[model samples]
Target chain A: AQRVTQPEKLLSVFKGAPVELKCNYSYSGSPELFWYVQYSRQRLQLLLRHISRESIKGFTADLNKGETSFHLKKPFAQEEDSAMYYCALRDPYSGAGSYQLTFGKGTKLSVIP
Target chain B: DTAVSQTPKYLVTQMGNDKSIKCEQNLGHDTMYWYKQDSKKFLKIMFSYNNKELIINETVPNRFSPKSPDKAHLNLHINSLELGDSAVYFCASSQETENTEAFFGQGTRLTVV
Candidate 1:
């Protein structure tokens, strides 16, 4: 079974500090990885996807197949960036063409000013 | 306008009570899904429907039933809810394509006393 593992339960960092949230996945076939963010009292939204190869709000994640990791990174974290981050993986080979995502335990990011 | 929406943002009911959560998406996506977030913030896929067809049904309890009257709405009904079923339920939608990302609604926090 495909699984996503996010090792950190909570991470605290000072404003303007670089931030990296670790994510690792276990899947046999090629995997599509994504990062979703949930702000305080807000709905979850897509932050970025590996297939897009784009950065949203200064966050970028590179897919490392050898390491089975897709770590979200930011050059300088802001207080506004404080939110819960979840890593998800979609198995393309899962039959019926259903969009089922296996999500990791979210990491609560606390940015201290 | 809200792209995806779920009714009754907070629901508190006694155990063994029957409850239902309604979801609607204006994004006109072809796929809708139900996900559960446990107390520890672990998100897991519960069920998925594409064009009102059940495509992915995870190892959820039989008490949990998903109904999609159309492509734009997917509602979840729980019968004989237990304390263990208390969690945040999220409704999401996505296009039936490999590269499309899922858009999520504000979750329904269901508390079974």
Candidate 2:
């Protein structure tokens, strides 16, 4: 079965410091990856996807096929960056009419000012 | 208007009680899903419905049931809820074709006492 693993349960960083949240996946075939964020008292929302190859909120995640990783990174961590972040893998069975997502235990990022 | 919505943001009930969480999506997406987030912050897929038909049902317990009256509404009815069933339930929707992004509703927090 395909699985996503986020190794960090909590990460605290000073404001303006670089932040990196590690994510690794186990899959036999090409996998689609995404990063979702949930701020305090807000719903979980999509932050970015590997397929889009676009940066959102100064965060970017690159799919590394060799390493089987899609870690989220930001050059400068802001107070607003503190949130629960989840790394998800799209189901391989999603061919045409299916949409299934498997998510990892989230990493709580705390940006201290 | 909210693209995806779920009723009763907070539900507190006792064990062995029956409860239902309602969800509706206005995005016109063909696929809807229910996810459970435990205290450890692990998010897992429980059920999925596409066009009012069950497509993906994870290894969730039989006490948990999902109902979709129409394409845009997917409700979860849990019978004989256990103490372990306490978690935040999230509803999400995505376009069934060529779409990897999913929009999630504000989650319903279920607390089984």
Candidate 3:
């Protein structure tokens, strides 16, 4: 079974400070990792994916297979960047039996002004 | 237009009553999912459907049933709603293949009284 673990329940960082949200996963096969964000009153949306290897809204995540982690990073956190972030892993070999994701308990990030 | 949409964005209902949340995606994706976000913002997958067929059914209670009429629509029907059922339900869609990101809806907040 593939499981995602987000150790932090709440993270606080001052504006302009660097931010890192930790995410670790357990999977036996190749896994696809994703970062999803939900801003206040907004819909939860995809922030980025490990396969894309692109930065969105100044946030980037690197999939460290050895560490089994995909930590989201932002060089300088902004007040508007405060939101709930969730790490999700999809099983590549679930086949017709399963295509669901194992999501981590999200981290609530607060960028203090 | 929204890529994914869920109806009754805010549902306030009494316990023991039955209710349904509707979800539709305009992105032409083949896979859809229903996720429950609890009070602490922890997300858990309840169901997944591909082309109107069940793919993943988590260890959720049998009272919670998901029905997909087609590839574009997936609805959730809850029987005998409990206080534990109160949460934000999000609908998402994505390509069946790997390397694709799932797009989520704004979410339906179901409040059981």
Query: TM-score: which candidate is best?
Result: 1
Using Cα atoms, each model's DockQ against the true complex is: 0.72, 0.67, 0.67
User: Which residue runs of candidate 1 sit more than 4 Å off their true CA positions?
Assistant: none
lDDT of 1 at A20: 100
Local accuracy by lDDT, each model: 0.91, 0.90, 0.90
Give the DockQ of candidate 2. Answer: 0.67
Candidate 3 residue lDDT tens string, B1-113: 98999999999999999999999999998888899989988899888888646855547999998888877899999999999999999998888887677888999999999
lDDT of 1 by residue, B1-113 (tens): 99999999999999999999999999988888999999988898999888646865647988999888777889999999999999999999888778578999999999999
User: What TM-score does structure 1 among the candidates reach?
Assistant: 0.96
Which pairs, if any, clash in model 1? none
Location of the lowest summed lDDT over 10 successive residues in candidate 2 chain A: A91-100
lDDT of 3: 0.90
Residues A1-113 of candidate 1 have per-residue lDDT tens digits of 88899999999999999999999999998988899999998989999999999989999999999999999999999999999999999987665537788899999999999
**Can you write out model 3's per-residue Cα lDDT over A1-113, one digit (the tens) per residue?**
67899999999999999999999999987799999999999988889999999999999999999999999999999999999999999888877525677789999999999
Residue pairs of candidate 2 with colliding backbone atoms: none
Give candidate 2's whole-model lDDT.
Answer: 0.90
